[model samples]
Target: MKTTIAVLGAGSWGSVLASVLVQNGHQVRLWTRHPQQAAELNNQHTNQHYMGDYQYPPQLQTLTNLAAVLKNAEVVLFTVPTPAIRSVAEQVVPILHAQKACPLIVHASKGLEQQTHLRISEILTATIPAPYRQEIVALSGPSHAEEVARKDITLITAASTSLAAAQQVQRLFMNNYFRVYTNTDLIGVELGAAFKNVIALGAGALHGLGYGDDAKAALMTRGLAEISRLGVALGAQPLTFIGLSGVGDLIVTCTSIHSRNWRAGNQLGQGKKLTAVIKDMGMVIEGIKTCQSAYELARAQNIDMPITEAIYHVLYEQADIKQEITALMQREGKSESY
Candidate 1:
């Protein structure tokens, strides 16, 4: 059966997922805020900035009109950066309402809103109007856009309070190379996805600071513990942190050179200023903002996320990376178990 999926952003992940849907025999309409970029994607069949060499499927269409993009769409996948979700949701709802259409809303974005510190789905649920509220689902995992663009084997979890909604996305995105699992723990999945980017920055910083695999491994392991701790504090199932959206995501984001958060951390560890790092990397490094939100959330909830705190300090207060890492290492030792 063919489905019509409206992808709300044309960045790396959005473009790749749109192409994947096209592979699954669906009509995918991808929208970008830039009209010129829309023309480039549709005419050139490539998103040069985000996806370098990967060509888009011809079946995929690019458009600038939001109303047209959402018209008759069965699914709307939000792939924009976290900061943009609220405004986009606010803008798109009236269009959907005008059409009298209700579609499953799936978000692949991973980050907490800055002040509210809400998860991506939480923001969506709050912003999206009531009639379409239960249709929200979160799609998250270790899958990288670059790898998925090449059709590499990738696994992800689709989570919703409504299992039926999660399974709908599971079936929509599943294929031989792309595997999708359904989960009801939306918080764990979204938190795991958001927190790992912070850890990946730590992992990358460790590497950039001339540390060995041992250092990276330790950071990753401890990072997962803290993520699980915070996830549990937020009312997510503890075991969800061990699943694909948790440990699986942590491993990939922390280790992969393809991770923007890791790359940003690497640059910062190499003694680049935060301003320079942000300017040089022409992408939305979610971990930077996510670190702020996570730190705020931890303080508010009395959760101990030491690693996130250290990373947040480095990114925000210009704390020396070496000093932060050293402080982390010298902190009073505790039991290894989360």
Candidate 2:
């Protein structure tokens, strides 16, 4: 079953995903907003700015016209940033309507809409036409673009309310090196992906402050607890936190140097301002935005998420990171409860 897939976004994750699809014998056409990037990928088989020396599959193609690629694509994968999801979905609506085709919608983004606090799947459901809305699956895990590009063994979750939708994604990408697991817990998978980034920020900040290894471990552990609490409060399964999209993701994003969010937090811990860190990263550090949205969501739902609140204050309110840490430590202790 060779599928024609249209991958939206040419960032690190997007390009790598396109390459993997090409390797699986799918006709992959990457949609990039920048003409130069598309031209480079087509001509040199390398996206130096995003992928860095990783050779794209020779069969992969790049296109700037979204409608052209949507022409025959059986699957539309979104690897864009949270802020861009809405606009991109809006752009795809008429194209799908015009084509009279319904493709399996898969979103790999790991952030919520800042204003609406909606997950990527929810955003797409609201933005795209009803005809194209069957089951939007979320593909997420600890798998980073760099490691996946290197053909490292990676595991991820494909979650959707529709089991068929999830299995469709699993068969589309799973291989010897990449394993995909299907779960019907859409809320859990989506929240796990988004909230883990918030926790990863705190983890990176601790590392930047030269905290002890035990402190980092405690943060990661407690961070998982906080993520679980908030996620369950928001209608997600608690056990999902222990899965690849949850604990698995938190471990990699918090400790790996390849994580832009962790690197951004490291800069903040090293006494750099938020604006300066964002400017220097040259990439969208999703944790910063997810911190804001998740903080607001917790408050709105009366959910207790101390770590999320702490990172939000540090990133947006200019609160002293150490003071936030001290406050977190000084809070009334609870009996190791989630």
TM-score of each: 0.98, 0.98
Candidate 2 lDDT tens digits, 32-122: 9999998999999999998889999879989999999788889999999999999999999988988888988999999999888999988
lDDT of each: 0.90, 0.91
lDDT for model 1, please: 0.90
Candidate 1 Cα deviation (angstroms), residue 284: 0.1
Worst 10 residues of 2 by lDDT: 126-135
Task: Give me the runs in candidate 2 sitting further than 4 Å from their true place.
Answer: none
Clash pairs, model 2 backbone:
none
